[model samples]
Target: MGTMEAPILTVNNLNKQFGSGCDQCSNPADRRLDKNYCPACGTVYSCQNITFDLHPGEVLGIVGESGSGKSTLMRCLYFDQEVTSGEAYLGPYKEGRSNLFRESSQQKRYIRNHLMGKVYQNPVLGLRMNFSSIGNIAEKMIAAGNRNVAAMEARGSELLERVHIPVYRMKEAPKNFSGGMQQRVQIAKALSNHPPILLLDEVTTGLDLSVQANVLDLIKHLQRELSISILLVSHDLGVIRMLANRTMVMLDGRVVEQGLTDQILEDPHHAYTQQLVHSLL
Candidate 1:
């Protein structure tokens, strides 16, 4: 994606916390804590001043170890978890004028259903285990106000096929599928609405190496075919290297580094980032 084009999505100063702040942690500039936690107040800062932009038809990867707030950031953007404070703008929503975080619940639901789709790390969170795979895809379409059963069925089968899930198995429930298949079904469901922006939160985290490669290849092909903008979250630098054009590195609830994927890999500036790259070597 070119830098001249406006970003498809923009996030500013996003923050999420698990507990109320005490006197010691009230002011961000003066707060003292263990990593992201405030010892005296027991408040955990899951995401702190997180900011980034996702360009059209671009894959922006967020990489960090566990507890680095990468997943929490995805949750906030997808509206699965509320942000403590932040502003997000979607280029296609209100001509990029509204702050998505401040929208009403009804509007937020509208955006979630129509403007974006998310594939969670866990299939259970994204799909109904007991429902047929196609039914799960239809559920998302229904949320977006689709009423024609025939159209949904056709679309569901098309998507599942695109993800390499056999058309014959579309009637099966996700619980009966293998871990990789479950994730593929989740991807199909997320793409049901043909959303412009996709939030992928560690979609290949628990799969075998071969399965992970298969899923990643599917994502790469689909992204190019559909020209969909993706925000991909993972702890694996290798995954980021394969799929991301730009990369953001998070640490201790904050963004420690970000740049072109190649530049960061070759000349990492942060100490933590250096360690991560060294491990890859």
Candidate 2:
């Protein structure tokens, strides 16, 4: 990303806590740092003072091990969960100045409908197993206010093809499809509105290596085709390296390090990140 291109999304002082704070749990130092557990009251702090900026058309990867806050952060940004504090501003909203965290429910719906798309780790989370694969795609289009059946189905069919699902299989239920195929359907549906930003959470986590490669290749192609920004969260550093321009290393509910994907992999600054890099060797 060019230095001159303003960030499309900026997250500042983000925090997600599971329990109400108590006097014993309140620590000023903890407020400024990442602490997943309160020493005094045992509250779970899922995310702590996390901040980052995603430039337009860039793929920002969040990498971490299981139990790290990568998925939690993604969930917060996409509004699948609530944030305890801080602000996330989407530059494209309100002429590049709306704080998404401060948006009303109706306005948040508008932002979700118009600006972003999300693909979850589980295909079931993103796709309706009982619905026809094509219908799953149209569901998003309909939610976005497209009422014309012909146009919606046509658009769905077009996206199915784009994701490498055979157009003939569009009428089949995703429940009957292979996991890889189901994921493809999820991707097609996510792209229904051509969102500027896509949030992907472990889209290829369970697939076989070859299948993962195919899915990854498709994503790479779509990034080029659509020029969309992506916030990709995965435990796999290989996936992050392949997809992200910038990578943030997360550990125990916070970004411990962040830099160019290549640089981060080649020369990790944090001990946790170093351990991660070595483990991949």
Candidate 3:
């Protein structure tokens, strides 16, 4: 086997805040310090001092409870939401690196267009729910400048095939598919651009155990075949143990422990990590 290369994405001190936006009022309806959205004050700080690196061919799992800022961090990294402060470094070389927090529109667009791909917790949110599966995937390809219908269609077909979605269902709207199929379709769409790094934000949430296992296996197969680095966020320990190379445990807006998956699972250092592990059992 060849030696594995290093990470393509690194995050340092990442932070995001809502309600503080000039657009929101002083007496905001929602506010919380650790919660992505504040309940009392309407101020949301996704978290502070959050950091991690995603290596090629590696699956990094981020685990925390519901209010632990996992989704907010995902949004910031994937560009769905703004970064309040700090840096998200992409790629290895300084020349190729970018700070998601401060990059210009053109720069951000370029990075998003070329390197980023994301799968949301809810597949419908990530997908063009109104379009056929093929149209949804192809729309992303076309927007990224693929205009040859024959090639686009062929590629789209291959994508669906790779995700185990039958070509006959290509014209059906995602609404017709089960939650699992929708997740698979969303994966196909994310891979349409051949992104180097794929971020999955709670992709298996709310699914039945069997379906969740299938989706997890599918993602592992894709990662192996495509050599794409993955950053997976979840509250499930079983999922992390099965799929991740490294795991990061978070609590009250801080990373309490991070290490190889097996190590963290078997022997966690922090009290919060211990509690999380015990709870999982």
Q: Which candidate is the best by TM-score?
A: 1
Which of the two, 2 or 3, has more TM-score?
2
- For model 1 the TM-score comes to 0.99
Which pairs of residues collide in candidate 1? none
Model 3 misplaced stretches (Cα beyond 4 Å): 1-5, 19-42, 92-94
How would you encode candidate 1's per-residue C-alpha lDDT over 1-281 as one tens digit per residue?
57999999999999999999999987999989899999998999999999888999999999999999999999999898999999999999999999999999999999999989899899999999999999999999999999999999999999999988898999999999999999999999999998999889999999999999999999999999999999999999989999999999999999999999999999999999999999999
Candidate order (lDDT): 1, 2, 3
Each model's lDDT: 0.95, 0.88, 0.81
Cα RMSD of predicted structure 1: 0.7
Tens-digit lDDT string for candidate 2 (152-215): 9889999999999997889999999998998899999989998899999999999999999999
* Model 3 lDDT per residue over 1-281, tens place: 12365567878888666656433323325332333444556665557679887777788899998878888888887777788777877773354465666877766666665677889998867898889999988888876778899987888899999999998999899999999999999999989888988899899989988999899999999998888889999999988988899999877566778999999989989888888889889
Please list the Cα RMSD from the true structure of every candidate, rounded to 1 decimal place.
Answer: 0.7, 1.7, 4.3
Once fitted onto the true fold, the runs of candidate 2 whose alpha carbons sit more than 4 angstroms away are: 30-35
Candidate 1 Cα lDDT to native:
0.95
